[model samples]
Target: EEEHTSCEIPRDAIDVCGVQDPDDVSLDNVKEVLDSIKVLFEEDKTIKAYRLWKKLEGLVGQYEEAPQEQELSDKLMNAKELITESMFMLNQVTMEAESVFALLEELDSEEGWELAKDEAGIRTWFKQPEGSPTYHIKIQGTIKSPIFDVLALVNEVDLYQKWIPTCDLSKAVLNISKFKRMIQLCMTPPSPVNWVVSRRELMLYGYGVDMMEDNKMIAMAKSPSPGE
Candidate 1:
């Protein structure tokens, strides 16, 4: 029998068919984002990968299901004063990438290419910092591949189950202006535990933020109305 690849999954299939294996991914040679970065100055290909990967890793956390009880949500939000933490690690990588790129440019043309990492497992400059809470994360990057197509996936609810692990349903109450969206979501964790959870979210997005990281950055800057 032929191996069942992801492309084989039928449309409207509710369950997430497979989780991407980290080992099968290659982060090196991250798609060199020459348009924006190159315009600013020069940068290494690896550092670009590093910044982008960290940003992507940050999204995995955004996929978390809402808390079970209203009380729990209140307690959690009140305690933390927010639903999620801003991605500091990702910003750090961006700065680091910029630094390395500057270093590479100063060296001879031969040296810049020499300094660039072109290995399979490691990208040109993305680095994993040592520490807690962040070390568990890994960056798997791609460059200019037709594979990402994240833009098309934005409003495609069916595809969420394919990539986001905990999304049961995502109903868009509004999409007028990116910041004005109100979305409802439910929890659907991986099985051995294939049951729905009671918690729901009607969060807003795109306000109180500027465009960042090729537009993958999502900052919730507003609260939705009760009905919205």
Candidate 2:
């Protein structure tokens, strides 16, 4: 049989979010982040994303500062990146992620990283600036599948690992009102390319299935930091 064809999605369809002050986030704060980022490629406001990204990093770093198992710290900073979006949202995430990082790389190269690999070193370099998502991958295909069936499958919540790209595990947590769930997955593709890992942690990760009661998956998406 031929490989399955997956759906396509637009890049702006995602919500780039953080849950640190989830309770405090108002529509205004979200609008500010969105507006500031548009000028990120311009020299002036680039620092805004840097500052925010560093604050986010500091939150993670503080955990590292606490006495913890070496294994734990490694896992924290060296988190394998997760591609939280489904095939429907993959391409959209990719273009958005690329735009975010390209701007950051330009700034970081000014003082920080050389943006080049060290030929002599065993470790390869991944160039992500202070405030940037490391990277994101895009996968596209078409399925003869229908949307209502997909919704029924989503109600099951046990079938994602078989088809969803980024998810390693999934389970339903909220049923009717919100339709929420928990998911975990390895960041690397089904086949690992090369090592030297990096990640943009999505403070919150979720999957949603769209349907019209006929039992097919018309659309699905995820919210997480896109990857490199």
Candidate 3:
């Protein structure tokens, strides 16, 4: 005879496994989880794994099958596995999003950047951050057009090749919301460099918001975390 071990649910989570009225005890737990996930999602819209897991949890909770002790235990174990995977994925995405902001913060500081070019009303700086082989470049220039006009032009992805230097293609990969989207940009190096470098492609997640009170608009973008 083979011996089998049973999976046990924590006393607090027993209601979630259908041992008691889920609405009574589990509602608080569900709300807590949702609130935490909501905060994370708002901070980084790329965290979709938890939302997907929550939907699955709702479907499982609504199953018509009688909740036997063993069956409930099995369901709880499966849910635990799903929650673990979802949390791991969410954490990975959150870390990547934080790194993007961290780099931006570093760039905001004036200490490390060295002026590389200053001509034709355009200024450019370059920085070789510690531990990075590649150099980070920053270009600053004033556009003569109105902010709204510039924003409109940027939002028109098809017009990128016409005005953006070395741009070969630009298109939206996903329209996440009215103001947020994931885009793909392909840049070809100029002349002889193109033969040696080939075409480079970037996957960027970007958003634009109008600050009505400040009478200004802001647009930001960064490469999305993997699997996002």
Candidate 4:
């Protein structure tokens, strides 16, 4: 009878049950940290951080069973936590940036708007951008009420229908912070028009900036992007 011999396969050579070789596991935590820091210098840090966090989170799952790399796993987890905190802080920065850009877009020029109506101390201007069926309208008027009072009236979303003749439905959909919220408004057309045209519903992102030192307050509203 020939002597029987047993041979053990090297762990690296085994490919059972989708388990990765210890040598093949590459967390690259340092590279991820560097990439996250690079995102800080780029535009839209909130979005960038979110994407990176998702990527790292996937990696964490992929290497969950990795061998002898507890330190690297801990570092990756720490990195993910840090990115989450950064995301919250970056969200505020993004909101401020959006506000600044919206202000610039609205106040950049008067060249495109054409006078549509002027009566009773109120002026209305309309601008139809190329290729867009809808028109951009601007209404200008002076309110005799104090600035703070006007600000309060605007911030009170539930009472919009009581004050604005055209608005029939107004409500706050989401409150982001003390000074910012998402609002929904429905405008009812005049008698003859209302009979034919459906109510126009608008989803707006609104925020207020108090400039007490300048004795001025600015409240801005615009359509929110899908991501928000």
Candidate 5:
């Protein structure tokens, strides 16, 4: 059987369709490319969109500040706005992806860790496959404050009693080095013991994470020093 195929035009073609003039310097191609990029971003192809945004940023720069060419100027401005919007969205997605990947990688590494305690934004874990006399505690969480603020709060020995509920007294005993300290903490338990005094060796280690540095503070106390 012989079949005939025919193209049908929509009823709204009169309102939506137009012929492109050869002399008109329009940004139709740029608009189409930007629209496709928007679709890619919507589909969670952020890396691709980001790459395109960087390329479009350069292309759009060429037509910028051309007052004599009003049409070209308008097209460039439109492209610039679109590029900016795409860049902002792509950056946000990139940040979210990084955060999620970091958390996932951490979880993957901690294959056998059991959640011991969860409070607010902090999570604590008890070490599995134990082999040492000292119990190891693994704490993992994200703080909304800047990393510097966290490091400062941890290293300030004088502020411990003010913030810690069990601490009766806190003092900086000695500054061994920039990354180490000897701190004294006195605690009064609910029992008959009047006071308990102890000294802790606080060691600080910092490592870079993206644009910021993450600090790890380790406090070790084997035997309590005599309090006079």
Candidate 6:
């Protein structure tokens, strides 16, 4: 006695069977269709497998209870096994894609982002908002140093050129309090795109903002909205 593999007809195969012309339904043709779908699954083409599975699910229903054709019955059982495997792979791929998208969103508040590249201690992530050419960029990192010492060095605008390796000149445009200021910066190897005179917002974690649980400093440079 041969070992019998038991399998149920996939829903897509049933649907395919339902929509076919009544005159066109035949055991040989249905068997051939199932064989084709099994080949796609064996080829590791998940997308194609998913598509064929759907087609098979619709068609399989018509012959599911047809106990007359032994060959057709065997082929249908094999097709079900292949379709089940294909659907599992497709589900895994979808879950992985969603997880990566969530991580990127957590990195940047903006949505519809793709990871361009990352190297060294710096991480850069960008997104084109509203289908525009302009990209919103976010960079995050940590530097090991005495907290106060680093803050003092960063707050001294006039001393920028001395410590900021790439800065040619840094001048305070306006001192808007200890928490906010506007500064003009010129880069050492200046290019038109690298030049920026922007308003800077400084948040001292322990002093005022409730979000910062530790004594950490955050600096944000204001820029125009994307596509401006």
Predicted model with the maximum TM-score: 4
The parts of candidate 5 lying over 4 Å away from their true place are 1-112, 118-120, 128-134, 191-228
Write candidate 5's Cα lDDT for 1-228 as tens digits.
955443334433322323122122235555545554444445444444445555555555555633437667666767666656555454644553344355546555767677899999899987646576665567878779986887788777789889886676777676643433566777655544434544333322211122111222222222322320
Scored by lDDT, model 5 comes in at: 0.51
Candidate 6 C-alpha error for residue 198, in Å: 17
Question: Which lDDT tens digits does candidate 1 get at residues 1-228?
Answer: 844322222322212222122222222211222112221212223344454354434433343354446655544344232212322323433554544445435432332122245566553433234563432222234546453365456656445556666766766656644333456566655655555544445454322222244443332323443322
Each model's TM-score, in the order given? 0.28, 0.26, 0.54, 0.55, 0.34, 0.36
lDDT on C-alpha atoms for all candidate structures: 0.38, 0.39, 0.60, 0.62, 0.51, 0.51
> How high is the lDDT of residue 39 in model 1?
19
- Poorly placed runs, candidate 4 (over 4 Å): 1-85, 118-121, 211-216
Best by lDDT: 4
- Report model 6's TM-score to 2 decimal places: 0.36
Q: What is the C-alpha lDDT profile of model 6 across 1-228, one tens digit per residue?
A: 845453545545534544223334344454544444433333323234445445556666766856747777777776566556555434533333333345445665645766666778777777777968888677767778987787687678789778776666777777643544667776644455345644333322111111132332234344322221
Assess candidate 3 and give its lDDT.
Answer: 0.60
Candidate 3 is scored at a TM of: 0.54
Candidate 1 lowest-lDDT run of ten: 27-36
Model 1, TM vs. native: 0.28
Instruction: Give the worst 10-residue stretch by lDDT in candidate 2.
Output: 80-89
RMSD of each: 23.0, 20.0, 12.0, 16.9, 21.6, 21.7
Candidate 6 has an lDDT of 0.51
